[model samples]
Target: MNVSRCDLLRWQFDFTWSLFDYHLERLQPADFLWEPAALCWTVRPDATGTWVPDWAETELDPVPVPTIGWLSWHIGW
Candidate 1:
């Protein structure tokens, strides 16, 4: 069966929204802001009044770890 382009898009959107909604529903307030690492990026402001990743100030030798808070904003946006 050949599915129309619009049907495919709607299916994709529904699937994605279902998965996103499932995760969001399961996420707790504390878990949403949990930082698993010492240098995980979050929504907290820094000394410069900027909400930057905790690893933002660190050298770029290693990639910065993103926290749940960061991921939520990043994914939503």
Candidate 2:
């Protein structure tokens, strides 16, 4: 009945990722790229032509919504 701090953190992390994986299984390609609004963050090519997140485009005032691709990348990596 005793859990170390590291053990607790690991359990929480695992559970969170499990939930993420579950939902990820249900995502479609269109769902992954869906942008509810303009200026939202999502995955795209960087200046170097490597695929990267568009987090730099985000602003805090309006709290821009993130696309599923961005959420997936954020949680998966």
Candidate 3:
């Protein structure tokens, strides 16, 4: 009963996506930009009106909590 590497990878991918889909389906529009804390990182529109994620050249002492939108953009980035 040996599973091929490809099969194992596919299974892993499917499982991961299922978990993501579960949360994704439950997300509300407001959840995307909801700041859970006073100090948090999120996406904001630039002067040109293009949305961008808050980022730092170097990691800060306290990593900022990311909003759902930031997390999503991060995953895609």
The lDDT of each candidate is 0.73, 0.86, 0.89
Segments in model 1 whose C-alpha atoms lie over 4 Å from true places = 1-17, 45-59
Model 2 lDDT vs. the true structure? 0.86
CA shift at 44, candidate 2, in angstroms?
Answer: 0.7
TM-score winner between candidates 1 and 3: 3
TM-score of 2: 0.76
- On lDDT, the stronger of 1 and 3 is 3
> What's the alpha carbon RMSD for model 3?
2.9
The full ranking of all candidates by lDDT, starting with the best, is 3, 2, 1
Identify the superior model by TM-score, candidate 1 or candidate 2. Answer: 2
Instruction: Score every model by TM-score.
Output: 0.56, 0.76, 0.71
CA lDDT of 55 in candidate 1? 39
Number of clashes recorded per candidate: 0, 0, 0
Scored by Cα lDDT, where does model 3 land? 0.89
Q: Candidate 2, residue 60: CA error in Å?
A: 2.5
